[model samples]
Structures are given as C-alpha cells and as structure tokens.
Target: MMLAFILLPLGRMFGQQSPAMLATVAAMPDVQGAITLSLEVAMASAVIAAVFGTPLAYLLARSQFRGRALIEAIVDLPLAVPHTVAGIALLFVFGRNGPIGKIAGQLGISFWGTALGILVGMLFVSIPYMVNSAREGFASVDLRLEKAARTLGASPAQVFWQISLPLALRGILSGVVLTYARAIAEFGAVIVLAYYPETAPVKIYELFLSGGLQQSSAAAVLLLSVTLTTFIFFRYLAYGRAARKGRNQ
Candidate 1:
C-alpha cells in the first residue's frame, strides 16, 4: 500500500524526466533562483526554530506548570491547521494593516510580498516539528544525570550546556532536519504571503499553471533530487553521531 501510494508516484515522476530535460530545467535562471531562495529561507527558518524553540522544548520536558498541556497543544497546533488557513491567520498579524506589520512598516520592514513573509509562513507551519522533536529529545535524557551534576556543584547553566544539551543533541538535530524539510516544501502559505521571490515549490506550481505538466515536472524532479539528497546527508550525520555515542558509552 505504501509503495503504491508513495513510491509508485515518485518513481513515475522521476521516470518521466530525462537527464537532458532535468539539466535544461536546472540551467534556467528562474529555477536556480527559486531553488536557492527555498534553501536559504528554509535554513533560516530551521535556525530560528532551534534558537527559540529549544528553550521552550526544554521547559516542556523538565517542568510542570499551569497550562503546560495547553502550551504543548498550542505548539502542535500548526500541524493540525491547514496551510492556507494558517496563511490567512498569519495575515491578521503580519499583513500591511495588521499591528506587527504596521509597526514593521514604520521601521521600513514589510512582510507582504517579500522573503520575510515567506519565512514567516514557513516558520508558522514547520516549528511544531522542531519543538516536538526537541521536546522528545530533552525528555529522553535521564533526570538522574542532571541531579548528579547538580550534586557535584554544577550550576544549572553548566548542567544544561554540558549534560542536557549534549544528551538532547540527536533529537534537536532531527528536529532541525524535519523543520527544514517541512519549510522547504511549504507551498500554500508561502504562495499566499509572498509570490514574487518564488521558492521552488511556488515556482513549480507556477510552471504547472503556466506551461503545463512537462515544464513543471522537470522542476519538481529537480527539487525532489535536491531535497532527497539533503535529507539523506543529514540523516546519515545524525545516525553516525548516534552510533559513535553508543560505542563510547
């Protein structure tokens, strides 16, 4: 069933594209620009997620407080929301007349029809993968190790930086990979928010709309190749680290 639904279509998509067609599509300035933008923005989104979401993930893993469940639910809400709906919801806060947008406009920053808008859209949908994966990572760390470090006069910051963070690195790295993949693949929200500085997904969509299947298929395959290569490389790194850590232990 999985092969039929997933692998079959993917195989067919790749099979339909010749190397010459792929090279031609890859050579296009617009395709190159769109793919580059997608990679850059997605990477930025992943970094931002790690910076902000890590602490929140740790908090969720280590502490219990009022509304903690609610917080977790809220963090995971994006996964449940439709991307188009998420875009519309974001526009309320980031649109030109919206509060943040209005304030940002005064500072000469605009979200509408810009890379910032695309970043915001990608971040909105992809952050859950980061937070959830990181939370699980943090949760997996043994509490006893942190307690032992504390008993030995380690500061909370020291314990976190030396113990907790290291132990949770795999999960955090996995979250980052997932977040990047999700961000790069975002279409509806990115398209709604910023269409000019086209990301690969948006560009492929445009190709499909304007030039039909043959044109779009080549670009789609190119994106698939890039995404798959990156995903595999990161996953290998993560797995290699885990294997080394296990051997050391």
Candidate 2:
C-alpha cells in the first residue's frame, strides 16, 4: 500500500518523461534559472536556520524555564500552519506598509516579491525541522561529558564548542538536510510571497498552469531528480560522518 501510494505516482511521473524530454527541459534557461534559484535560496535558508535555530535548540534541550513550553509550541507552530496561511501571515510583517517591511524599506531591503521574500517563506516553514532536529541532537549528548569538561575547567563557551557542538552535529546536519529539502519543495508560501522570482517548485506550478502536464512533467522530473540526488548525497555525508566518529570513539 505504501509503495503503491508513494512510488506509483512518482514512478508514473518519471515514466512519463523520456530522457530526451528531461534533457530538453533541463536545458531551458528558465528551468535552469528557477532550479538554481531554488537551490541557492534553500541553501541560504538552511544556513540561516542553523545559525539562528541552534541557540534556541540548545536552550530548549537544556533549559527548563517559565515559558519554555510556550516557546517550543511557537517554534513548532509553522509546521502546523498551512503554507499559504503562513505566507499571508508573513505578508503582514514583511509587506510594504508592514512594520518590519517599512523599517526594511528605509534600509533599502524588501521582502515582498523578492528572493528575500522567498527566503523568508522558506525559513518560516522549514526552521522547525532544524530546531527540533538540533534539539534532539543536543539532548542526546551525555550531560556527564559536559560536566567532565567543566570539571577540567573548560569555560561554558569552550564546553559547548568542544563538547556539545560536535556531539550535536549529526542532528544539526540532519536538520539542515531536511530544512533544505523542505525549502526547495516549498510552493505555497513562496508563490504567495514571491511569485515573480520563481523557484523550481513555483516554476513547475507555472508550467503546469500555462502549459499543462506534458510541458510541466519534464521540469518536475528534473526537479525531483535534483532534489533526490542532493538529499541522498547529504544524508550519506551525514551518516558517514557519524559512522567515522563512532569508529574513532
């Protein structure tokens, strides 16, 4: 049932497109541009998520505070929100007359209808993956190791850098991979927020609308291929690192 439900549709989609058709679509400048944009923005979103989410993940994993549960709920809220609704919600903050948007305007930065908007959309929906994964990673680290480091007179910063970060790296990397995948696959929020600068998903949607399934299928296949390839490669690297670390220990 699972195979029929999951693989059948994907298999049909792939089977519909010949290598030549896929090649033709891949060669199209617009297709290439959209895929490139998606990869770039998704990578940026994943990095931003890592930098910003790591502290929060660590805090959530290690701390018990008055509003910690509330914070966790809020962090996970985006996953529950529909992407289109999330986009609409973002527009309130990132729109031209919106608070952040107005302030950003003064700084000559705009989110609406731009790559920044796409990044925002991607980050909004995908950051939970980073935060949650990293939190788990942090939580999985044996506290005794950190305590041992502390006993050895390691500063808090040094303990975190030398002890916690490396142990949590696998989870962080997994989060990054998931975040990138989710960001690249984002369509609803991105289309709502930055339709002009179409990412691969948005471009495929456009092609579907204007040119129908036949025209769009090739591009879809190309995107699926790229996404799957990158996902597999990164997952391999993450797991391979974990294996090496295990052996070293």
Candidate 3:
C-alpha cells in the first residue's frame, strides 16, 4: 500500500512531460526563490542543530541530572506537538508585537517574515532528530576506549576529540541528514511564521491552491527530486563509510 502510493506519483511524474515540467519550474521565479530559501534556511538550521545538539546529546547520554527525563521530553516535544500550535507559540515570542520580538526589534534583528523565522521554525521541528541521533551515537561509544585513552596520558578533552567524537561521528552525520531533510520539508510552522519568504513546501501549497494540480506538480516534483537526491547522497556517504570501516575491521 505504501509503495503503491509512493510509486503512483513517481509514475505520474515520469509519465508527464518531465522535461517540460522541469523546464517550467525552472523558469518560475517563485519556484526558484522558494527552493533557494528552503535549501539555505534548512542548511543553516541543520548547522545550528548539530552544534547545540551535540553537547546536549552528550550530556543526556552521559549524565544523570535531576530533570534529565524532562529535558529529553522537551527535546522530543516538537515531534508530537502540532507545528501549527508551535507556530502560534513562536509567534507570541517572536512576532513583532510579542515580548522577545520587541527586544529583538530593538537590536534590529527580525524574526517574523524573514530567514530567522524560517530557521527557528525549521530548528524547532527538526532538532529532536539531531539530538536523538547524536545521543544514540554518544551512547554507542565504548567508554572503555575513552578510558584507555585517558589512562594513556590523554586528557578528557583529548580522549573526547580522538575517541568519543570520532566514534559517534556516524550517528551525528545521520542526525544531520535527518535534520536537513526535516527542515527543508517543513510547512505549517514556516508558513505561519515566514509567509512572504515562502519555502518550497509553502510555495507548492500556493501553486496548488491558486492554479491547481498541473501548476503545482512541477514544482513539487522538482523539490521532491532535489530532496530525495540529497537524502540518498548523504545516506550513501554515511553507510558507505560504515561499510568500509566494517570491512577494515
């Protein structure tokens, strides 16, 4: 059933005048703009998620602090939360009329109707994937290896840089891939928060609502192709590296 649903659209996409469809979306400014914005904002948010998420993941995997469970729950909240609700929550904090928004306005850093808004929306929706992937990665690291390095006159920092980080890198890379994909595909939160600078998903909705299936399918197919291609590339890199390591072992 799942394959049927998936393959049917793919068939239609290929069955159509694919070259013309590609050319049509290629010529549309809104389509190109949305694609560019989605890629740029998604990449930026992925970086942010990776940087902040790594330490949090390490802490979660290694520490046993009070409220640790709560922290984890918070990290996973967005997955269950309606992103439209999340968008509303964000608005109350980042909208020009909102409290944080007022303070940010003083600094001339806008969130509403801008890239920052898209970044926040993407980050909120996608961070759990990064953090969880990294946490699993960090957890899977053999502490004995870190201990061995430490006993070999290596400091904690050295052990982490040389042993733990490298060991967990595959998981982190996987998380980054998931983060990037989620961010690019985000719709409701981004639409609510950063409407003018429409991301690809929102643009697809716009085309669909205004011009119907024919107009929208081209853009949607292009975005899907781009997303799927990038996803496959990353997956190949991550798994191919792992396969090589396994063979070496």
**Relative to the true structure, how large is the alpha-carbon lDDT of every model?**
0.94, 0.93, 0.90
C-alpha lDDT (0 to 100) for residue 226 of candidate 1: 90
Q: Residue 42 deviation, candidate 1, in Å?
A: 0.2
Candidate 2, which segments miss by more than 4 Å at Cα? Answer: none
Ranking by lDDT: 1, 2, 3
What is the per-residue lDDT of model 2 for residues 140-218, given as tens digits with 9 covering 90 to 100?
9999999999999999999999999999999999999999999999998998888978899899988999988877999
- Which of candidates 1 and 3 reaches a greater TM-score? 1
* RMSD (CA, Å), each prediction: 1.0, 1.1, 1.6
lDDT of 1 by residue, 1-249 (tens): 976998998999999988888888899999999999999999999999999999999999999999999999999999999999999888999999889999999999999999999999999999999999999999999999999999999999999999999999999999999999999999989888888799999999999999889889999999999989998888877768777987999
For candidate 2, the 10 contiguous residues with the lowest summed lDDT are 16-25
**TM-score of model 2 relative to the true fold?**
0.97
True lDDT of residue 231, candidate 3: 84
Task: For each candidate, give its TM-score against the true structure.
Answer: 0.97, 0.97, 0.94
TM-score for predicted model 3 compared with the true structure: 0.94
